[model samples]
Target chain A: MLKFTCPYCGIEASETELAAGGEAHLKRYGPGSSEQDFEGYLFLRKNPKGVHLERWRHVMGCGKWFLAARHTATLEVFGTYSAQTHEPPAEIIENIRAKFPEWQA
Target chain B: MSDPRSAVGGAVYEGYVTVKDSGAHGMITLRGDHAELAEAVKAAVGSGMPTQRRIEGGLGGGAAWASPDELLLFCDYADAAGALEKARKSLEGNHFLVADVSDARAVFALEGSGIRDLLAKLCPADLSPEALPHGEFRRSHLGQVAAAFWLESEETATVICFRSVAPYVYDLLSEAVKGGPIGIF
Candidate 1:
């Protein structure tokens, strides 16, 4: 089972204690946006083989949500950050870039 | 008002490990800034917040850390209302949430030779003394139900789970010891 560290509680929780929230940092297309933009926002998702960012809630533990960066193929987790932030922190971006130089955060 | 009955009473198993009902206790889920809430909590519950993941005992009862900003205060069910009122008074202007969830959970105590290994079967959290130690609280699961557990001493532990599923958890634990030190619960 995958292990995750909760940014709010500082506990390293097993995957069972956490709930995956699929994809992070999605821009909302509401009200004035084009239909295609709204459709993309609602239905489109990136399923990259390497270096992906996602959201997770510590459901059985602290009940706080957080973000995690991981590789879909290798299962190597880069790091976890607080859910309160609007963007990924610079150090995390740097770590991902170091591993996949062509990738952008 | 009616008194709450114990979810699972009497000893269900007589083996190397024993399980007993701890009865219903007054429980509060308090959340706020730890440093700020510590004083108010001490005034209200007769004990201060435990240092991250620990449990502290005092004249009134015991306080267990549920998370970084949360503390679970447990006392006699009869005294819970009064304790919550006192804590609210002490916490006056702070940004906090104090919820009395006394009936939400049923508590049980497990003690014996292989209780740690038995707990390891059900919970993913490390139960080794060096890692968990005494007085440390961990929130995890007992099968599919959510549970919070802590070590009272070397051979003893207290487990709290949702009231509705207390019997199911007890039965699962009972089945674990029937086969003489099974690998999984």
Candidate 2:
């Protein structure tokens, strides 16, 4: 079972206490956008085998949502950050870059 | 005026630990900037504002941090209205929301040496002495419902959950303690 430290509450919560929210940093394509962009936004997702970012909610703890970066294959967690930001924080990006030199943000 | 009634009607259960309804407790859900809330909380409950995941005073009259921008203030059930009024008046010009939620919630007292073991069975939080020491407040799931709890001392804890789920939560606690101490703690 995966354990994640909630960035908001500073508690290490198990997978049972959290609700996964698919991918993170998703850019919504609203009205006036092309059908292709909307389709990609709604259905397409990056299935990287390496470092990936995802959104998780501490449903049983502080009930706050946060973002986490981890390796999909190795299950090595890079870091967790507040959900208020649109992109990963500089520190998390640096941490990920340090481990996976060829990985792009 | 009508007398207030607790959600469980003062239910009590005896097993490895004692589970009893703590009766009606005044609770207010306060949400806003913490800086503005500090003054409001002090004015309402005569206690300092709580830090992250902590309670500032005793359960009789204290403030517990519920979230980044929210606090759960406790007081006497009879004084809920007055306390809420004071909080609102103190935060009149600030962007804040405060409400008396005493009737909307249920409180239970768990007493015994197996308090941690009983709670550890239901909650995902680390209930060890070092992790959830006295005065530390935790909001998490108890069984399937959302619940919040804090240690009153080495052997006592106060747990609160929605009034609608009082029976469910009470049963969960009562059953969890029926088999005697787990001795994991």
Candidate 3:
């Protein structure tokens, strides 16, 4: 089981204690946006194999939602941060860049 | 109107480990910065936020740190409503959320030499004295259900779960205590 550190509770919660909330930092394409943009917002996803950001809720624990930056292939969690912000933290991006020179966040 | 009965009827199962429904206790979920709510929290529960994952108890009952910004306060049912109101009033004008969850969950008290062993079967927590000493709290899953449990002492633990599944929690505990070679004896 993949263990996730909850940013709010400061606990390394087990997978059962968390709920996956799909990809993070998705821009909403509401009314007035192109149909293509709206459809992409509704259905599109970036299922990258490495260095991914995800939204997870510590439902069984603190009942708070947070974001995590992880390597999908290795399951190595770079870091976790509060969900109140719209973008990933700079340090998280830097860590990813140091490990993966080819990718950009 | 009649007083409410415990969700598990206060059942007591005698085994290597004894599991008892502690009955309906007053449980409140409070969220705010401890630095900002320190005085108000102390006034409400006789204490402030507990030291991370620890529980503190006094005349007003116990308070456990639920998260960095949240605390769970527990007390006798008779004093719950008044304490909540006073706490709310104390923190008036502050950005906070205080919710009374007394009816939302049930408390089960277990004590005995084998209590820790029993927990090993149900939860993934370490449960060792060094890993989870007295007054430690953790929110985890018990089998398939969500539960919040704490080590009140070396030989005692208090588990809180959603009231709707109190029976399930009780049954799971009972089964664990009465099924194995180390348990049923």
Candidate 1 CAPRI category: medium
Error of model 3, residue B102, in angstroms: 1.8
Q: Candidate 1: where are CA atoms >4 Å away?
A: B58-60, B182-185
lDDT (tens digit, per residue) of candidate 1 on B1-71: 79778888654566677877778788988888888887767776778678887889821387888877788
lDDT head-to-head 2 vs 3, winner: 2
Q: Is candidate 1 or candidate 3 better by lDDT?
A: 3
Instruction: Choose the strongest candidate by DockQ.
Output: 2
Measured by TM-score, how close is model 2 to the native structure? 0.95
Q: Which candidate comes out best when scored by TM-score?
A: 2
DockQ-wise, the better of 2 and 3 is 2
Which stretches of candidate 2 lie above 4 Å from their native place?
Answer: none
Model 3 C-alpha lDDT per residue in residues B38-89, reported as the tens digit of each score: 7666777777568877788832377888878898887787778877997899
Give candidate 1's error at residue A80 in angstroms: 0.7
How far off is residue B25 in model 3, in Å? 1.5
| Model 3: residues with Cα > 4 Å off, grouped in runs | A97-99, B58-60, B181-185
**On residues B9-103, what C-alpha lDDT tens digit does candidate 2 reach at each position?**
99999987999999999999999988778889999999998888999986678899988889999999999999999999999988999999999
Q: DockQ for all models, in order?
A: 0.68, 0.71, 0.59
Worst 10 residues of 1 chain A by lDDT: A1-10
Q: Could you give the fnat of all candidates in order?
A: 0.57, 0.63, 0.60
